[model samples]
Target: MNIRHYFDLCVEAGGQVFERIGLTDDYRASRGTGFFTAEHHIRYYAETRVGEEVSVYVRGVDRSDKVVHMVALLVNDTTRRLSCTLEIAAIHVDLRTRSAAPFAADVATAIDRELAADTADWPVPVCGAMGIRR
Candidate 1:
């Protein structure tokens, strides 16, 4: 599976949830121009195939000034495996002055709520569990 596709899926899924809860206007509007900056890091620990149903669960969100940081986990249903984990940091800024905007309280709340909901039952096997000849 392509890692970029997985990352895009997570971003799109998270953006939808955020919009549903009125976190930001829209992802496109929030991008570039210093309005919003997202630095995403994804780690793929296991192999995943096509046609597998996956779900992205937000784990946490943090805000400092205009920056909003989010952590999320992606799980595959077929194998009940964690396909990848992502950490994203987004900054909110003013389009006009190119300065930081006051952190939106609603955005923060929505992010936290999403993360809490998805992290309920996380199952990832430890490295020791995978059998390998020493």
Candidate 2:
């Protein structure tokens, strides 16, 4: 298994869940912008072997108009344990300007809904120095 693929999977899963308003292809195309990962931290709790069945669960944790916090869990189904957790902070970007940009109204509303609806049983493992820049 490509371990790094987990991060990509997490991003893809999040994009799909928020595709209606969060960083969708239409948004990128129409707005000429997209989301860029600003920070990433992973905490490993257990080893997930190649043959082990693992599920990737990703959810929004919080958001601002320009940034969003998300967490992804890699669960070892065979062992019924969490293999790892990924914390990601991503920013909306302007493709043309190459700078942070605010999300559209609909996107912000969708992010708000996701943040409100998302829940977790465990605390997210985050690095001390990473987050949306003030």
Worst 10 residues of 1 by lDDT: 125-134
For candidate 1, the lDDT comes to: 0.62
Error of 2 at 61 (Å): 2.1
lDDT of each: 0.62, 0.77
Candidate 2 Cα deviation (angstroms), residue 69: 1.0
Give TM-scores for every candidate, taking all chains together and pairing residue i with residue i. Answer: 0.68, 0.84
lDDT of 2 at 9: 60
Weakest ten-residue segment in model 2 by summed lDDT: 1-10
Identify the candidate with maximal lDDT.
Answer: 2
Tell me how many clashing residue pairs each candidate has: 1, 0
Candidate 1 lDDT, tens digit per residue, 44-79?
867778898888776444455566566567889889
Model 2 alpha-carbon miss at residue 103, Å: 1.0
Cα lDDT tens digits for candidate 2, 1-134: 46676656666666666575556677788889898888888777888777888788777767877998888788889999988878888888999998999887877887788777756676666666676565
